[model samples]
Target chain A: MTYDWTLWIVFILIGLATTLPRASFIVLGQRATLPEGLQKALRYAPAAALAAIVAPDVVLVGGALEVFNPKLAAAFAAVLATQLSRNPWLPFIVGMGVLWALR
Target chain B: MSPNFREGAREGFRVFLPLSVGLVPWALVTGMTMGGVGFTPLQAMGMNVIVFAGTAQLGTLPLIAAGLPVWLIVVTAFVLNLRFIIFSAALARGFHGVPRAERWLAGHLLTDGVFATCLEKMLSHEDPRWRLGYYLAPSLWSWLLWQVFAFCGVMAAGSIPKGWSLEFMATIALIVLLVPMARLRPMLLAAVTGGTLAVLLRGMPLRLGVIVAIVGGIAAGFAAERWQGKGR
Candidate 1:
């Protein structure tokens, strides 16, 4: 099949954005120290960002509130799995399974 | 293989194996979404191989489908991935002695799960090399699984049922992942504040409201941290 340049361009930009940060640290070595405020900001970034992404998707559906989505239920189950088994993969699988079954 | 290469590869494989399963559903959903948005299987797989970031990849698909300008798509992705800048800086401190090439390889493998796991390990371990291996193993697995399953999902596009509601699976996985991380008051506050803001601003165009909520959450978290007298 022929290549799609449009898609290729998008992919390349994404790869660059994803890789550059990691590579920069490697290149800069000991010279790198994030600003104190930035580091402080970074500490809470992931959990906050992740919650920002997931909360709406879980609690809202079809422009209405849906706190009890099968997905959320399964996610709760997965949380239980993680707590019980302390296994990362277990919760993901169980959560997905619960979602699939519920769907 | 050189000793370091062997070590890194072994570490990579070890982490890759267990993390692979969790990534499959994520990749599959991303691939299906790509297909739904008119991306050919080849394009979808290509995006997975190149981007390798599940959330950002999924986030961009809607923009592409909506025929938004390419530059906007690029900008949005850049903003979404700004968190990596912080992640990289934190990780950089641990790699002070490592050679450039090794550092480059590690950079590619860094991800949310890997960074979290590795940082925790680093706090407990003194040896940078050991920390590298411990972290790289799981992240490498996650990356490999993500790409492989993404390709599979693309190839199986038409055959995959539409009503599977993979979005819900994504939501569940995300929630499961977030719940554990929100142990601190700041983290819990960030989640609640961000979630509320996202809901309040849901009507905003181009998902800008979500972005606003994220920024708000970050600021709140920063304030909370300062109040608690924690961190630099």
Candidate 2:
């Protein structure tokens, strides 16, 4: 297949997309100030965004809710595993293990 | 570097070295997905070298493969990287008199774990040079480790068994990341709000649901915090 030059452009833009936001406050220095309330709210944005990404993946399958699915089960197992151990590898090991066993 | 600067850098690297364990799975997943989804190895690694944000890179893979509009993909990435905006803001608090160019470089090198480590270890250090040295070591180490493992994943993607169900692992990775952040009541509320909304609004075109879910989650969190304050 032929190269799509726009794909390269998209790649470069994605880089800027990450870099600009990260550098926003630093570049602006003290001139720009985030609202106090907004700053508190921003604390939750990352977790919420991550949950938003994950919920659709495990809670719904093929655009429909499947509460009893293996993926969901594995996710719960992963959470439990995380709580039980501080080992960084436990979640992945437990999670994928449960997913594989159930499937 | 001065003796103080070298000592600070050593302490920073030592503190962050243990946490680098968590970076392995994430980096590998990011790289494997990029290559597995049909990008050339060069393109995949190039994306790593440039975008440098694993979550956004992974989040956009499906959209990129689906041939979504360029602007939409870029917007999605910007939203995905919004957390970095907060990170930059919080971390820049101690950088008052640092040169503009150095601040810009520091912001660009920032990563999720490195930010937490820096805040915990060196944010209050009296010397600017020491703090600078402390921040740079871990950030650079994280960056280097990510690039190395991600490159391995990109090269190994072809050999990994197809039945491994790698995509699900990516989801699991995100779940792992989210669990520690959701310990507080307000955070849990935010996650539930964002997640439920994402599911309900999944049909919205162009994956706008993700953005709405994030906003909804943040609002829910803010409201919960306010309510808790009144009860105290």
Root-mean-square deviation (CA) per prediction: 5.2, 2.9
**iRMSD of prediction 2:** 2.6
lDDT per residue (tens digit) for residues B105-146 in model 2: 888887889888888555588887788889888988989989
Stretches off by above 4 angstroms in model 1 are A1-8, A64-103, B1-39, B58-83, B93-105, B112-143, B153-158, B230-232
The iRMS of the candidates, in order, is 4.0, 2.6
Clashes of each: 4, 0
Q: What TM-score would each prediction reach against the true structure?
A: 0.71, 0.87
Q: TM-score of chain B only, all predictions?
A: 0.69, 0.85
Q: Write candidate 2's Cα lDDT for A1-103 as tens digits.
A: 2236667888899999999988888678778878887778888877787788778878887679999999999999989987888887788789989999998
The 10-residue segment with the lowest total lDDT in model 1 chain B: B165-174
Error of 2 at A53 (Å): 1.5
True interface contacts reproduced by each model, as a fraction?
0.57, 0.74
Ten-residue segment with the worst summed lDDT in candidate 2 chain B?
A: B161-170
lDDT of 1 by residue, B132-189 (tens): 6666667767877787777776666657566655434445445655677677888888
